[model samples]
Target: MPQCREVPSRRRVPSTKITVPGPPADLVSRPRLLTVLDGASEAAMVFVGAPAGFGKTVLLAEWARSRDHEAVAWLSADAEDNDDRLFWSAVLEALGGCGRIPDGNPLRLLAVPDAPSTDLAFLGQVADALDELPEPVVLVLDGAQEITSPHPWQGLRALVRHQPAGLCLAVSSR
Candidate 1:
């Protein structure tokens, strides 16, 4: 039998200054860019795809800081996170960091090294929870190019496509 362990509850951590070197000077004043991107996200999906060193991450980070949203979850994707289970777990934890999980009960459908396929029903529960938010919730997936599998992408695409009205997604990839 699979060992059932509860996923750790995440808490809302105050945003810390992101220290990335050589951020463009002019990029800081572009409020219109953020406004447009935020508007775009409200209407449909917005993907920031660019090669490495294009300032995509910095731009999004700055924009997130400027927003008045209650919570913002940021996950820096690594190579190992390509695994669907690990990726989602990190995402869930990051969401927790943003105070998205209600009542401190985190539903765990995947365990490390188990590679169990994602359960859509559980995802539905998460989506429902996100929809109930009183204010907009922003989830930022940085370094998204690390995700190589189509399955996780498909799941993320579904989530983005069907995201609750109050939930917003911002993805950056090289």
Candidate 2:
């Protein structure tokens, strides 16, 4: 019988790509700025306050592509999601797009009508989920300022102010 050599154990590695596309030539500078912000030790919330043609979304999409061990979620704010409940539901769904939503009841509350009052709870759940992740996540909210409703923005601000170590938020407005 031939003896088999013992193989070394290897650690399970997380995926490095998050499917974020790069920006066009016209929006190059913004990506660089985002890179700088991302590298900081402190948590950051980037508010891209500009008009529609300012290329905020393009820059963020590109910057997200270059990150290592990062997940990206894009939410296109629409009039239908004016309510905090609806907005968060959309946000969570977007996070799902990047494989960020873990399996649990934390998202179950989204089905409830009065979920907005529990915005902090949702934020906590999101933060906890993201904290368990080995990679960082970037959530891009395009047309964020259009939300108009105080509740959604309040929840968003709260999330930004107390973001998990592995999560970051980038909001763009016109």
Predicted model with the maximum lDDT: 1
The 10-residue segment of model 2 with minimum total lDDT is 9-18
lDDT of 1 by residue, 1-174 (tens): 999977533332223311222346666556777887778767435678889987788878777677653366677776766667667667666666565445543332223233323556656666666776666667777888887887678777676667677577878898
TM-score of 1: 0.73
lDDT (Cα, tens digit) per residue for candidate 2, span 100-158: 44555243223323554355665676667767666666777777766776777777667
- Write down the lDDT of every candidate, Cα atoms only: 0.64, 0.61
Off by over 4 Å in 1: 1-28, 99-117
CA RMSD of all predictions: 5.0, 12.5
Clash count list over all predictions: 0, 2
State how far residue 169 of model 1 sits from its true place (Å). 1.1
